[model samples]
Target: MVGAIILWIIMIAFLFFILHAVIQSALDSSNMAKNIQDIRDYLYDTKREGRTDKRAVAEQLLSTQPGAPQDLYEECPACGEKIIQHEPECPSCGLRLKD
Candidate 1:
C-alpha cells in the first residue's frame, strides 16, 4: 500500500512539473508573438508615414535610450570595434547588437 502511494505521489509530482513547463512555454510563445506583432505594426506605420530613412527610424526605435549620451562610444564585446550610440549593426562583424 505504501509503495503504491509513493508511486502515485511521484506520478503527480511529475505531472505538475510537466504542466508548469508547458504553461511557461506557452507564455513565452505568446510574448514572442506580441513582440513580432509590435514590430510589424511599427514597420507598417513607418511605411505609411513615407519615411525615406527607415534605417534611421529603426535605429531610433531600437537603440535610443533615455538619459544616454548621443555621442558616447563603446567597445563591442564580440569584435572589439568601437560602436557609437544609436547604432545597431556592428561596423566590423555586422552583429545585431542592442545599443
Candidate 2:
C-alpha cells in the first residue's frame, strides 16, 4: 500500500512539472509575438510618415545620452549623401572611400 502511494505521488509530481514547463513556454511565446507585433507597428508607422532613410530612422529611434560622445558624419563626394565618418564605402553610391 505504501509503495502504491509513493508511485502515485511521483507520477503527480512529474505531471505538475510538465504542466509548469508547458505554461512557461506558452507565456514566452505570447510575449515574443507581442514584441514582434509592436515592431511591425512601429515600422508601418515610420513608413507611413515618409521617413525612409536608414540613418534618419536610426537617429530618430536612438539618441545619445547627455554628455555622451557624438558620432561624426560627412558628405559623400560621389552622391552628396551624409554618411558616418570612417565608413569604408558610401551607402548611397557605393563609392569606396578608403583602403
Work out the TM-score per prediction.
Answer: 0.35, 0.35
Candidate 1, residues 5-99: lDDT per residue as tens digits? Answer: 99999999999999999998897689666676777787788889998774466566555444545556677779998777557878789988875
lDDT of each: 0.75, 0.77
Colliding pairs, model 1? none
Q: Could you tell me the TM-score of candidate 1? A: 0.35
Best by lDDT: 2
Residue 10 local lDDT, model 1: 100
| Over 4 Å off, model 2 | 1-40, 64-69, 72-82, 85-88, 91-93, 97-99
